[model samples]
Target: MQGATRTPAYAGRGGSRSIIALAGTLITVFIVNSLIGLFAIQYAGDADVRDQTTLARLSHALDTAREAQVAFKIQVQEWKNVLLRGGDAKDYDRYLASFEEQERRVRDRLEALAAAAGDLGLDAAAMQAALADHATLAARYRDGLALFDRTHPASVAVVDRAVRGIDRPMDEAIDALAEAARARAAAIRADLEAARAERYRTLRTVAIASMLVGIALVGAILVRTSVRRA
Candidate 1:
């Protein structure tokens, strides 16, 4: 009878120890999982912020470039209309000045965009080439205006050709750049989304793994205690 009583007491003490050990293991796993989750959240947030900032800058640059292109085109068309109307010399001079001013402003805007692009690690050689083409067109336009001042009938035709030459190539270059910027923005957005998904996956996996470990520890403790009791 005494032996039976002592056996139960011994078994009870062993069960308590097993339960404590299991609890400690569970606590450790919980802490580890919590840390991992926190880190993942932080990383995801940082990536999202960086991607958003880049997208905003790219969008702004594209908008500015497009606006500058439109303004330049309008000026060219106005000059063409003046020449077609056989306007006076003063009118021609005024139109030429206006065209030059618009051209200069567009160039300045392009330069600003290039500077912003440099910060974004963009390839700016295309932009530079486009700008060079624009300069050539401007020079040709100025020459054509000079011919007009001298009463040359072919001046209008030459100016028209020059404007066409510059406008088409400039438009193409701007379109290409805008498309590239949009593609990059799309890629960044996709990457950010993927990162967020991956973080969630990681957290889910950690939570599941932690739960499994806890259950296993509890089962092991219960089993050991049961064996000791038997």
Candidate 2:
């Protein structure tokens, strides 16, 4: 009897190779998608960090501005008190000392706000306008103090007039800046949340796709082995 020729299992070999190729393609796609997702998450995180840093600087600036405003108000009140007391020598001297200290504090706060404005990319024109207003007010205060040092009776009246001129506008400007800073902070926080949600969605999609691919690869392996045994 002639020995039968064994046929090469070309079909089975092709099928196995095709399955392997499909699995490799799926894995490559998954890896590429994962890398892209990771890069996006990193970029979002970096943006959020930058925004948070800016917010912190703005907060500090606002605090300094508030303190300066408070100091200015106190100085004005002290001057008023001195005038009420009929400009006694001792009271006038104390008022002068307090006024000088408060003026210095306001200047320091303004400098800090300017630095923070640079960091936050704030409107330069707005900053300039505010600075000009503050400088005018400060100059008036200085002139009043100089007159008071010479025992001029009109010094108290000048200081009171200067305070009245700038107080409301200055307060409004500070409030506006503070409100803008708070709004920006809130926006950044919202952006962070959106980024986090997008990241989670990407991860979930990758997980589901990976699980499906894994199961398909396992099924193909099992089917090929069983056919061979049969």
Highest-lDDT candidate: 1
Question: Which regions of candidate 2 fall more than 4 Å away from where they truly are?
Answer: 1-55, 149-155, 158-164
Candidate 2 has what TM-score? 0.64
The clash count for each model shown is 0, 0
Clashing pairs in 2: none
Return the top candidate by TM-score.
1
TM-score of each: 0.74, 0.64
| Tens-digit lDDT track of model 1 for 1-230 | 65563456766678788788878877876787778777767877887788788778877876777776776777677667567754576776677677777778778867776777677655578667767877877786666655553366666776566455556767677667666666666776677678778877877887788778777877877787677767
After TM-score superposition, what is the CA distance of residue 17 in candidate 1 from its true location, in Å? 1.8
Q: Model 1, residue 120: what's the lDDT? A: 60
Q: Every model's Cα RMSD, please?
A: 3.8, 5.2
* Residue lDDT tens for model 2, 102-163: 76776676666666666665555665676777677767656655544336666666656645
lDDT per prediction? 0.71, 0.65
Pairs clashing within candidate 1? none
